[model samples]
Target: MTMKFPFQIIDLTHPISPDSPSWDLDCGFTHSNFIDYEDCTSEIKFRVQQIHSPLGIGTHMDAPAHCIPGAASITDLDLHRNYLLTQSVLINVSHQTDENYQITKQDILDFEARYGRLKKNVFVLFYTGWEKHWPNPEKYRNNLVFPSISAHVAQLLLERNIAGIGIDTLSPDTADSGYPVHQLLLQAGKYIIENVANAHSLPPIGAWTLTLPWKIINATESPVQLIGLVR
Candidate 1:
């Protein structure tokens, strides 16, 4: 079928590999070739690979079950919610440092004041310029001061009926043991996309996003391929 609107697709996911940086607690991504073409004897050479990694590794989407008990899992997430074609808004919080940096409700209000009100079901993205440190576990994961979304800001987005939230960092919350933003968003049946790349390439508004997550039954989260369909 032909698309109604022509779009320039912008990838927003980082390549997953052994070198990909994951949460300190999650297992590192790895892959090995099980069947190589060099070992094939048949006329048609076959190759197979085995992969092992945690669900939260790489660019992924978190289901409500990730933090909320008795909530929906990766497979239970609505397809419409996982794959959405709606307006997206990018809030530039890149200037804010990790030390004492927090995205507050006031930040949302200020963004609206400058870029206009956020539309319902809009995919809200935060560009913290964190992707510049991609693939470097030391700089990207350990030493990085990731800006986190405050609980109040999360509630504000919920009130706006946002489809989901994405960030160019390992997570939407700080490295604290308790993640209030994740708890609030997930418990509300809203999804969160983490480790998003190229967020800075998107505009403050008017971009459309398409996020595709793996269908893993009863899984709390799944890696995703997020794309921005720019006009």
Candidate 2:
């Protein structure tokens, strides 16, 4: 099948690998060849590899079930309806934030003042300049002091009923905060994308996001292929 489009597709997902920063170090990514070429002695030769990765490795999507028991999991999501070409609004707070920075509702308001009011169901991405530490396990993790979204911002976004939120860090919540943002957003049934890459290249409001995740049954989270289509 041949398809075409007049848009620039930017890959927003970090390449997952054994060295890719994992939120949980114990669950780092690994892969091995199940059927190697050296094992094939017959005319038919093929090699099969198996990968082992935690749902939170690299760029990933968190289903509501991630924090809320009985909430929708990866398999229950309507990919086309919820993620297909969804409008993306980037809230660049990099200039004003540091590792311990917490994004607030005022930041969203500041963004709106510049990019115009965000519409419902648009995927909101935060460019925290954290991607600079990506692929560096120690730095990316940074003792979990990375920038995060405040509960107030989460509540405000919930009120707007945005499609979801994405960030260039390990999580939306600060480590010491006990996942307050995660609990609030997930319980509200909104999905979240974490460890997003190349977020700095996106416009404030003219890009659309296409999020595709591994459809793991009963899984609360899955690694995802996040892409941006510029308008």
Candidate 3:
């Protein structure tokens, strides 16, 4: 059977490769070609590649278990909660030129003032215009400091009961080890999508997000293929 989608599908995931940047605690992506078409005879025409890397290396989503002990893992997350196809809004904060900027409650409020209030179960994404530096370890990971979701803003989203939050940067929080935003959001049963690509392409509202992650049992996080369905 064939399926039809009513909207334009925009890919939001970054390709994972050996050079993919990873958090300090995670190993970089690596792969090996186990089978080559050249090695195959007339009887066998196939090739296989083996991938090795941490689940968090590429564009990925973080489950509650990523930070909180005994929390929901990637597989344990509710389909409705973690991977919902729902309404979304893009709060563009690229104007914040300061490195290591914090996305404050005012930023969210300003967005709402111009676009109306954010509804419940809506997927909120912040486009920092940082994806332009992707795959460059020195610029993307080390030198380019991206904006982060502040704790207060996290609380505001929690109060609004947003389905999930996504960002164009490596994480929703700063490079700091203590991720208060992650902790608060995850603890509230909200998931986070990091390293989102092409966020700048999305509109402020009227977009839908479908986040697809590997159902890895007991895994704290999983690399995801995010799709933005635009009307």
How do the predictions measure up, each by TM-score? 0.92, 0.95, 0.92
Which candidate comes out best when scored by TM-score? Answer: 2
lDDT of each: 0.85, 0.88, 0.85
lDDT of 2 by residue, 7-100 (tens): 8999999987788876665546789999898798889888989998778888999999998999999888887666535998999899965679
Residue pairs with colliding backbones in model 1 are none
Candidate number with the higher lDDT (2 or 3): 2
Q: Residues 1-231, candidate 1, lDDT per residue (tens digit)?
A: 886758888999988877787777444677999999999889999998899888998899998999899998988877675435567999998887764477889999999999888888899999888788886766787644666788899989989988889988888887763788899888888899999999988989888998888988899989998999888
Cα error, residue 165 of model 2, in Å, equals: 0.3
Per residue, candidate 3 scores C-alpha lDDT tens digits across 112-205 of 8999999999999998887877757557776435677889999999888899899988898876637889999999888999999998888899
Task: Please state the error at residue 196 of candidate 3 in Å.
Answer: 0.4
Lowest lDDT block of 10, candidate 2: 20-29
Number of the top lDDT candidate: 2
